[model samples]
Structures are given as structure tokens and as C-alpha cells.
Target: MPKLKIEDLARIREQARRATLLREGAGRVKITVHLGTCGIAAGGRNIMTAVLREIEERNLHDVLVTTSGCAGLCSREPMMTVEVLGQPPVKYVDLTEGKVKEIFAEHIVGGKIADRYALAVGSERVM
Candidate 1:
């Protein structure tokens, strides 16, 4: 490999700074998608894609979308946990592409939980 240039280092630093702002900025909403073996097998990846598309379509810069392993609920694969500041996390399960869009609109954008598709509301059962 060739020696690194100062311009390259500067570009990398700027990229890192932007990424940090995107993930750690104030008043940001965090969405975590479960992507363990079972989750993936149940279409977690498609759910994640739908979420990202929704965020982009809405031009939302204050939402941080991330993924994690299973929450030990294999039966509830393709699940996602949404966390907004000053609000208890809501876990939505059994996702499809269309359901993800609905969740994004109602829960993420409209400030109301999509109780229909949600498996739990702050640890209590919904379905």
C-alpha cells in the first residue's frame, strides 16, 4: 500500500465527524433492528431496508438507525425497538415491508405508537 496523504486523512476525519453527528446528535431518535440468525431468517434485513427508505423519503436527519443481535425472542423475529428521548422503548415485531412503513409514519413521525404491530409497549404485552 502507498503512504497515506494528509488530504486522505482529512477526508477520513471529516467522514468520521459526520457519522458521529448522525448517530450521537441531540434530540435524535434511535431505532434498533434485531438481526440475529432467527431475525434474519424471518426477514429482518428487509425490515431494516424498509426503515431506511422511509427515513430517507422523509428526509429525517435526527433519527439514528442501528441494528443488534436478537433480544432472546426468536419467535418474534424481524423485530425492532424504537427509542425516543423521554419515552419508554417500544418493541414492534413480525414486521413486513408495508408494516414498517406504517410504523415509521405513525410511531416515528406521528408521535403515536403503532400498537397494532407492536409486540410490547414498554415491556407490557400488546399482542
Candidate 2:
């Protein structure tokens, strides 16, 4: 591996800071991509890439993107959950790159749930 450069370190530092902020719930929106084995087989990686691309293209700093394992809906592989502050979380299913972009634009940025793609809203009850 090549020696790490100052610029690379700065970039890494910025990424860590952003992650810290997300963990502390500082962002207005949080997008969690489901990346389980089934999800990966169904293109979850593409969905994640699409979400990140949308954020970068929009120059958005208030959106947090993370990944999780299976959501217990294997049939809904390539799923993602979008949680906007002050609103219930919405889980979208069977996602593709185009659908992910649409969800980012309409749900993540516009603050409107993309109902057509959404499988459900709100979280499951915990014991």
C-alpha cells in the first residue's frame, strides 16, 4: 500500500467526524441500507452507492447514510430505511439504483415518504 498523505488523512478525519455526528443524531435524515447476504444478491450495494452519490451531488451534509444487516424481510432484499427527524421511519423494498435515487430525492431531501416504494412506515415493536 502507498504511504498515507496529508490530504488523505484530512479526508479520513472529515469522514470520521461526519460518522460521529450521525451516531450522535445530529443529521436531519438517516438512511440505513440493508446489506445482508440476500440483500447483496439483490443489489443492495448499488442502492447504497446510489444514495451516497445523491448526497454528494446535492452537497448535503445533514444526511446520514449507514448500513445494517437483514431487516427480517428476506423477500424485500435490497431494502432501506429512511428516517427523517420528527417523522416515522419508512422502509422501502426491492430497490434498484433508479428507485434509490428517486427515494433520496423525494423522501430524503423533500421530506415526503415515497409511498409507492415503501413497504411500511414505523418500526416493529420491541419486547
Candidate 3:
């Protein structure tokens, strides 16, 4: 394996710092990806990776990507929650890599709340 370059390390550190700064700001979007065993088994890692890549690709310093334990929705593994500023939080279920990309593009970036794949929005709200 190749050694990690200083610049690459620095960029990663920058991104991590940027993630924190973005989370602290007034205007930002928070994305929570479920990374429990079930979620991981269902490609949560891919979703997480895609989320980070999309933020970098779009220069979206305002989107914060993070992970959490399972919510006991194994059937809906690879679940993700999107909380855009001043908007309701949306939980999307049954995600695949392709769907993750589409979410990043259409909903995360384009500001369109995708209803087709959504499982829930908040407490006791399912779609």
C-alpha cells in the first residue's frame, strides 16, 4: 500500500474541520446515515461515501454528514435522515448505491424532497 501524502492528509483534515464548522453554522444541512450492522450490511457505507463525495464535488460546505446507530428498522436498512435548514427532517428507507446518488443529486442538491423512497419524516410520520 502507498503511504499517505501530506496534502491528502491535510485535505481530509480540512474536510473534517469543514464538517464541524458547517455543523456549527446557522445555515447548513445535516445528513444522518444509519451505520448499524443491518445498515452496513445493506450498503450504508456506500451511502456515507457518496454523501461525502457529493459534498466535496459540489463544494457544499454547508452540508454535514454523520452516522448513527440503528433505529431498529433493519428491514429498512441503509436508512438516512436529511435535515435541511428550516425544513422538516426526512427519513429515506431501502436505499441502494444508485438511489443514494440520486438522493445526493435531486434531493440533497436540487432541494427536492423525494417521496417515493421515503419511509418517514419524523416521529410517527411515515410516507
Counting clashing residue pairs in each candidate, in order, gives: 0, 0, 0
Clashes of 1: 0
What is the TM-score of candidate 2?
A: 0.80
Q: Which stretches of candidate 3 lie over 4 Å from their true place?
A: 1-20, 23-27, 124-127
Query: Top model by lDDT, which number?
Result: 2
lDDT value, candidate 2, whole model: 0.88
lDDT of 3 by residue, 22-116 (tens): 64654468899999999999889998988887777888777877799897889988899998888888999998877877887888888998888
Residue 93's lDDT within candidate 1 is 85
> How big is the positional error of residue 3 in model 1, measured in Å on the Cα after superposition?
33
Model 1 lDDT at residue 46: 93
Q: Rate the local accuracy (lDDT) of all candidates.
A: 0.86, 0.88, 0.83
Model 2 RMSD vs true structure: 5.4
Cα lDDT, model 1, residue 41: 96
Compose the digit string of candidate 2's lDDT tens values, residues 3-25.
99999999989888765665676
lDDT of 1: 0.86
Q: Which window of 10 residues has the lowest lDDT sum in candidate 1?
A: 18-27
